[model samples]
Target: MRFEIQFSGHENIRSNHQKTIEITKESHLTPQGDCIVGVNASASCADLPRELKDKLKNSDSKITFSISVENYEFIIKGNGHQDLILTHEEDIVIRKSDFICPRTLAVKCDKASDLLPREMVELLRNPNTKGVFSITID
Candidate 1:
């Protein structure tokens, strides 16, 4: 079976590099048996919860993730830095001490379907609508 996600929000957040951040895409199946999507956490540091910050700072930390969007949420039981891939087509080596600012997080999917709704795919392809997508898991 396949999972579908819808991302949408107009809130502007800045990254550590001072770039405007936004949610770019809804989650979708990848060739590597994973579901990947982008999130712009530019303003994350300013309001990041202390507990979450501590978890991210720890090298041995494994934090659980529950991303809620629309009427559904995906529960991921691990550190995003360790569990997700940074890119869709390439495997890059990331240092354990490396930090993830505002970026995409890839969630592994077992037997995830490659198909996606045509409309959703079109939205993803549109550059103008890049940062307001939200999610709904199926």
Candidate 2:
């Protein structure tokens, strides 16, 4: 199963968090939101399809998450958990800490925002940059 969320870059996209990466439906970002890579997200946890939501609740389900912008792309491997709420209305988060919450999309992620390539992070500092967030599971 797969789906994609569209988003745009922001001026405050520092992409410097060590344990999590997030996308939010809010169009504005503050400097303290270092983990948020994209703003004006096209979707959120509450917007996920029922099929994908089911898969994300299964402990055995694995997810491949990707963030692509211009010519740069980063991939993260993660897993679902029974504890996932997947109901946050505004945000979706990929976590490296195995934590599950309403905003958590997938846990045990291989990379957080801080691990992204600096070049890619640089491009994301432009508010006009377009980006895609994709999730796939088999």
The lDDT of model 1 is 0.30
lDDT of 1 by residue, 13-56 (tens): 11111111123333332333222333331222223344444444
**lDDT of each prediction vs. the true structure?**
0.30, 0.94
Per TM-score, the best of the predicted structures is 2
Question: lDDT of model 2 at residue 49?
Answer: 98
What does the lDDT read for residue 113 in candidate 2?
95
Off by over 4 Å in 2: none
Which candidate achieves the best lDDT against the true structure?
A: 2
Residue 67 error for model 1, in Å? 1.9
What are the per-model C-alpha RMSD values against the true structure?
Answer: 11.9, 0.7
